[model samples]
Target chain A: MAKGYLNFVLHAHLPYVRHPESELYMEERWLFEAITETYIPLIKYFQKLVDEQIPFRITMNISAPLITMLTDDILQERSLKYLVERLWLAHKEIRRTKGHNDLNNLAKFYYYRFVEQYKIFKREYNCNLITAFKKFQDMGYLEIIACPATHGFLPLINITPNVSRAQIANGIKVYEEAFGRKPNGMWLSECAYIPELEDALNEFGIKYIFLETHGITNANPTPIYGTLAPIISPKGIVAFGRDLESSEQVWSSITGYPGHPNYREFYKDIGYEADWEYIKPFVAKSGHRVDTGLKYHRITGKTDFKDYYHPDWAKEIAEEQADHFMHSRINQINNSASKMVIPPIITSQYDAELYGHWWFEGPYWIYMLFKKIHYNQDTFELITPSEYLSKYPNIQVSEPAISTWGAHGYSEVWINPGNDYMYRHLHAAAERMVYLARCITKPTEIERKALNQCARELLLAQSSDWPFIVTMNTMVEYAHKRLKDHIGRFNALADMIDKHDINEEYLEDISYKDKIFPNIDYSIYAK
Target chain B: MQLLKSEYYELPAKYNQTVIRLLVQSPTRMFVYWEVSDETIKEFNKNNQNYSDCTAVLRVTNLTKNYSYNIPVSPFANNYYIDVEDSGCNYQVELGRISKKKFVNIYTSNIATVPSDHPASYDLSKDGVLFGNYLCIGNKKRLKIYGNKEQYSRFQNQNHTAFENRRNGSSENNFLGSSDNFIGSSGNSMCF
Candidate 1:
């Protein structure tokens, strides 16, 4: 009469934006903020769990590109410098608010937290964050999964099957290289899936992958047990569908538990409130306010008078939210299990960065939820996808329906009218590269180099970020440039080969420039 | 291998009376052939450098083959492989050993190396190349391509400026800003 297991997966990803040419690009703040708010705090929580001898199991998907940025010495050094500056700014704010007891107390708390976290980041973790997650993974408290090389969208780019295959293969290679072992499951970029994609996943030796809610519910055979159970695809890979009810409670900005009146308001940062002249040191050159990680007020409420944020109160709210969420999940598992002939799994997936970063109390909530689940052993337990798959190997097989956790159930958000032009170019580039690869026989050294360069360009251009950027308009220009630069290089190389005036020096120069997929074969295009 | 004239290479309706000439070259001699096909030879044209038309041009240098036929090109039969016997520096020409249908197609063109005698070119200053420089194949004799010294120093300066801008919460016209407009768009537009 063991209770059903709850498999929780958190996906962590950010686009690569290490601006060696600019010391203060606003986009770079994404990584720093994630590091400060999400990564460092999660590590501390995991370490505490280990210290207390708690047997908590969690699954995480860390994208390869983020790992590359984390492991980079230059980025690490820059991040450390950035954190130190934040610490100093926090210290100043603590001193400035000395007369106001509540404000002063909150400022002091954040200042000390920054100082303590930075110490852990520098000394305990050596500013290399992956090792912390790896340590928990090694200790059996967590299972770490790999994601796409650059979080590239697989379904749309499956035009040349090899492009998608290479992304999967290369992703696994780099993931294993970083995490010290091969991953059991992979988080498909945006939970995007197509029937043909399963064949590629199976070919790459991936045993399990996750999908959105409808990907399973609306599946071809229409999963009889619903999202509460895992389905084995025709290709023998396990597919875990996300639970919508559980995800909504955490992902929704207005209704989510993080929006509790007691939690800190994510928007009311010190960067915008502090005096302009005094905060000039922290503002970017464009004068647009940016997140400085030092905030003063708790959410209070939608209409209530503002109250100074107290960490202790925030912790209480977190515990309450965790208890509520745990009870909801336990009820969900029980309700689902009773209806099924076998023990069901309730898979709750979320972005790892959501914890501690967007939702300040997220990691704590996770910690408390695990404790509550363990305490109530009769109703629920935490489990990883691998653990569940190993135990329930005889699950039903089905083909997941086409869907993504985007605007529509389809790829409209990532590939609609706003971004169609980018796709047109991408498709053209892919077709052309494939055509070029087929035409060459005994490629000269120059031809081989140019062809490889062309493949790299095509792959980079196909990255889902360019389209997302176009839709979001966050860094539309940068995304546009990336796509153009890569495609232009691809076309130019084609022109060089067509004219029989192959420029090896030029090819080598461009190859060194867009150095993604270093081992990618230009011959992939030839065929 | 047998060299049969493909029936899809028929002449267009507008050029029904046109007579196409064949030019086949080998080290020792050249052979010319003439023919007509009932079907049209409408080659499936892809802008890829590795397309059959481009590959045919490159392969012709060794053992060339040409057919003067009135048949329109079939979109599917766009590529053909030639077989040749190497006789010292010379080669014995053979035609149509491989067809597009039988061969796996490769669409990207091969990369050629920059010859030493070519114009002075910009060498990559960093171990990895940025996306901007991907379009720049060396040997631009007219434009002053930044050398390793200039490129590396400029990169360092830009990196410092970017870092400073981030530290101060500012967005300067550093490399990231300069390249912003071209980031998410498509088509043949260039970023500064």
Candidate 2:
């Protein structure tokens, strides 16, 4: 009867860059910008849906490190200050550029919106972003999934079984602390699916997880339907494969709705256009240039003069795009559902930052998409991963092929020659830390401090950021420094322990400096 | 009981160099501090006895030339305080409490050599600035120096040029006297 069930999953994450000592650091803006543009906006959309009785269903993966940062007092205060500054700047821009009707109007709109959002963020939630998302999860309007601690690229790091287990176990602990409940589903970083990865997920009681399209189609049992529905892993965990056709429409640069001529062009930003003197204060002194989040032109045309964007017009376009995407998904599910006896489930997963950071009208489009699906009962029904898995309990068990949701659908993006060098040291550190953890019996306070410092070092080194940074060649120094510093610290601690020496004060200082997991046990590395 | 023994060596008055040998008898990494000039120190090597050789030497003599290297210390390092006094042509140093198992080096050329008249009980503020009851070198030069309560208050207000001239022509000893005069309302001491 219905076109089939459509499950939308958004994975939200950013590397932790809280420098409490530094008043103004460039990398810290990553969280601030995401909070202002993506997280808060998505929360508002979901809250509105609940208030309007929209009955919309969405699954979101909020990584453990992100959750920690969201709940951190220093980060929360800085984010609020950042939002207030941006709002003030927007107001000033509106007044300064009063002659440009569209720009001025849009500026005013954003200024007021930021002010209202800041008030709601600070006053209502007491400046806590996690609580806002938890409210939606608790209300049953959204299903919040957890990711591995620090969003570690598990398949690559799973070189050892213990590393994988630690990632999963630590993730569950942090997720429970932030969300007040255990997660039912997990989002593997980059949708990197390995056969044994699911065992760890199942061990932690995760009922389902998402994967790339090929992970289902190329299943060992050979999925007959080919990513048209969810597949159950041998561990009894459900694997929802991303729908390729639907993904192409949203992710492809040439054909994606985000590339529509009316939408804002992401490349044209005030960072380059505005006077250097005026923008210098905002730009970091580190000699690296990053997006300043203020753009003045729309995509306009393939090769034409710039046309200013109007937020009102952009909202209208977003609605149209939402309608278009919904119809496309319906057609996709209808064609597949015709072949299967049961209603096929279409899983659409995307990076959450893409909504607001890349597509200015992304959150609006998502809101409208859910609205269209809710109204058109015959075409599609919005469902969470847990909801879908429970309804369709029977599924084919198989091991997914080695695949990732990256450019080539392979490991080249993360593990090529350019980045493989770091992997050797990373693996060595991981193995050595585990060895040390296991050999030590009844870890004293000093041993615990050293072990935790070693864990922090290994985890920071294990960050997908280092490899991605090397591949992109942006911030390669920073990524390299981070990896080396952590590895060096880990090695230093290991060397000390090997010689039967424990310097508690030095260990404690490093433990505090690189503190990420407070309750982390050194024994996790050992096992 | 496993005891970790560390050795601290005091520099000769005429050597203008200090070397501290830290021995970790229990076979562990040890963080040691030197109560000398704020010059940078480098670990030369570790012997079979697990003793590490750290060497510290003066790099610069004048206060004005040394002010530029006083950037805010990275939060990762352990910090220690030292007193600098102008001995007319050179500087005399008094070491403060050596931080335990913490490694932080102060570049003598970057900090104003401790003034000869620096007071007792240098109060290390919460912000990591050493504020003495009298004139004291801050994390930075002249502008950050706290001679008295009033000057410290003014420094907190970010009056950058407040103590600039005193940093240049006046030696560390004259700098202390200048602060005293300014604090005692002796004359309209130029802010810079």
Candidate 3:
């Protein structure tokens, strides 16, 4: 019998970045890269675990925007097209590195990997990745959760009760529409929580939410079990705080498993190393160099000069690190379980893309980690938050402190001086939207479509990605443009509604452009 | 085909409403931004011709502690970060002016509550089910950093100082975006 439980939660998300107007937008590649590197690899491994009849339980929250993009006809075709291009690039690499044994083996590895991904994407899943995930959920191997409609930072945008309500309700609506059932858990936007969020969670039937470490430690009256067990809020919503020790073991990029010298270097891609003309077709259409997902070097100890990657050595290290991670958890679980009446649950949560997208060997690390947990030890077993709640329904009740997983564990990352200008526009738009939702009773078909699109624009404009990107200083221009564009569209639609003269052509144009929530009812704001 | 002529990149400078908004930036700092419409400014100037001598100030009242302080801000500035001394307190702010000697209130903000940064003093369990000892490795040192008054204040303010350091080219950690330090993948090193 297991003495403790380990809940692994992965929040997979990306801002909606579809552009039908032109392919020159380099930002669209964000989706393609993530699909090939993160989502497909995850699906591949999950499918393998099921085939081997390995007992494992994992929870994942695929955000609403990502679900919309995954199911869209345009982006689906683009994902397949993107994989085909990578396949061709791998073919070229195989020919280019025929003589060098180390480079040739790595090239062949990529070639087969892309081929398998293409087959799984095109034939096995029929270009719809959500179906693959849904199959896993139905098989009892995975628990899929919901996220905010646009990945908005809830605390910053919670100016009025209705604003956060609309974001959460629409998020649930999207999850239900995609999965054919209500989600039992929700990955709070950035794991940010305020006390008022409980009403919305209970209304939407969300049973649990994960928080940062301090959210549990600093709770009112102090949680008796600390972050070792889930705390129940007054409203009956279960809140699980992340365990710092386990988080540091896997998430610390400097000391974590991803930084091992044998792992493939995420930075040393062939897009910039290749002859400009040779790699031009694989990169952005504007002729700018970008990551082509063909990195060949290893992260060889903080130096500019990197050595050719050895996949065999990387696999051995992933297994070794898996052993290290498992043993560390076994000890942590045993030390705490002896002192408690009930088995303590250590919640380890991370961004799903970090595995394969950022750390090329991350997905395999997860695969090996699960296998070790199954075969190597009985000290702790993998469990989802929902499963744990089912087994142990009674929990300590406490109100979590306001918190987020960002720097210094608060809203400074989203509301700092660098991006404080957007909140005014966002709040004004939400106020106008609530008023419109209340005032507009009966409407024509065109007016109804326009109202729904207006809601979509407001949600998109409020995404935390823009502020986060601006603060990160990586894609400032694109982030600024996206924020401005969404706000601009929202105002234009509001004016059309106010004038009582809707532009059919203009409405059709933006309806196609920012069409995220197809089933979005404007009355969600009224609730 | 180009859809809807290039999007207007600039937002309206003002929404034509005189309003003040307060947001909690951290446990120790609260951000307040307000806009006084031109019409409201004209109305204020009409009432007091000594508008030039008036300084725009935010009168922050800690509703929980029953104390108030004033932060003088430039009339032209749109926002200011107000520092709070205590966490877990309810604060209400008013955007007004100090003309000559009297305080004239323009608009009052919604009550903003700063979050607590330390563990509570009491546990409700009668049997004294204390779980603090098992919280982390080096539990005493970690609790000292989180529960100690002066140390907790410095730790909370370190995030802002870190940002300032990065802006001044003194630190390598991008704070929120460095993949080497931050757990999140907001870094630009691998972003396309």
Query: Would you list the rank order by TM-score, best first?
Result: 3, 2, 1
* Model 2, runs deviating above 4 Å: A1-3, A285-290, B1-192
Q: What is the TM-score of each candidate against the true structure?
A: 0.70, 0.71, 0.90
| Shift in Å, residue A506, candidate 1 | 6.3
Best by DockQ: 3
Residues A59-120 of candidate 3: C-alpha lDDT, one tens digit per residue: 99999999999999888998899899999999999999999998888889999999999999
lDDT of 1 by residue, A1-527 (tens): 55688888999988766655456567777888899999998888888877877788999998877887788776798889779989989889888988999888888888899988898899998999988888889988899998777787876666553667766776787788778998889999888876667656766667778988877876544455679888765445678999988899999877988889888778888788778999888766567777788877789888656777888899999998888888898788877776554578888999889899988888888888887777755687788988876665444435566657665555655755456555445655676777778888678877877777777667667777888888887788777766776777777788898888987766766654454555656664443
TM-score for chain B in model 1: 0.15
TM-score of 3: 0.90
Interface RMSD, per-candidate values to 1 decimal: 28.0, 35.1, 14.8
Q: Which residue segments of model 1 deviate by more than 4 Å?
A: A285-287, A303-306, A436-454, A492-527, B1-192
- Candidate 1 TM-score, true structure as reference: 0.70
Docking category for candidate 2? Answer: incorrect
Candidate that would win on lDDT = 3
